[model samples]
Target: MSSTKDIDALIDLMAKLPGLGPRSARRAVLHLIRKRSLLLIPLADTLQAVAETARECLNCGNVGTTDICDICTSEKRANGELCVVEDVADLWAMERSGVFKGRYHVLGGTLSALDAVGPQELRIPRLLDRVPSEGITEVILALNATIDGQTTAHYIADNLEGQVRLTSLAQGVPIGGELDYLDDGTITAAMRARKSF
Candidate 1:
């Protein structure tokens, strides 16, 4: 083992985090060491607190410091609109956007035949239960545009047909995006989802 074994191990662990490469992890570790009193110690304490208290919301599958997340418990969020997402990260992204006022249901993952992930593995059954139990009038399928995501959406739609108003997030060119810069798939989706203006 090297003299900096512990530091090397920290860098390796940090590199395992999403979007962080070996060089980035090394740089981050160095910065944290340089700013230990101001940043690293506080970050470590916060991480410990989160690790100790963070858990999944019982009703909606959102990760929070409580058994039920704030959104699920909020009366204002009882808007009869439930947005279905594939993961807690998707739920967080939607929250950050500050657009949707409805509650959310996290499916954990999509149905993947190769991965052997089915509806039971996800929160599909719980979602179905929530529609009637929570008096949900509409369900927005906010799954990703991948094949498995679409397949999961279709499955849920088929199951919930006639029970609630079904909708999905429109896919197309992003805001301020030029048509020339968009990929073929994005342009095609935009055309398909076009509306009369």
Candidate 2:
């Protein structure tokens, strides 16, 4: 057996992670090995724990350690507003802003025709269900500024017309920009200046 088999496997797995390449993974593995007690062991434990327990929230599609996420279960978050996002990362971005005091609806992805992704493929139906059930008075579309994102937002707006107030993040968000890339300040500003869709 190869003496470096396990190390090679670890590097391979790390390389598969987003934003990580084989070169970076090798460096990271070396660093982790050097700091085993301080970082590696703790990171490994946390990864294992999260891998086993992390799941998408049934109500809003947020990732957490429970079937229902903390935001969905919290009474304080039920402030009659629902912020809709194209992905869990976007939801997390909004949370990092610490400006919105409402719950969130993660759509999982945007509606795409090329990939054959539709509203049914996303959590659009569930979002519709949550509108009245959760007493959501406003739905802030915090999706990215891409064509697919805008298309999905418009579709949602059309579907939920007159049921509740509809708004979208302000125009400062660059075209094709995803929420995850925006700074907390920009997110807060966009949320604050949201206008009717």
Candidate that scores best on TM-score: 1
Q: What is candidate 1's lDDT per residue for 94-176, written digit by digit as tens? A: 99999999999999999999999989999999999999999999999999999999999999999999999999998988999
Report the backbone clash tally of model 1.
0
lDDT, candidates in the order shown: 0.95, 0.93
Best by lDDT: 1
Sliding window of 10 residues with minimal summed lDDT for model 2: 1-10
Each model's TM-score? 0.93, 0.86
**Total backbone collisions for each predicted model:** 0, 0
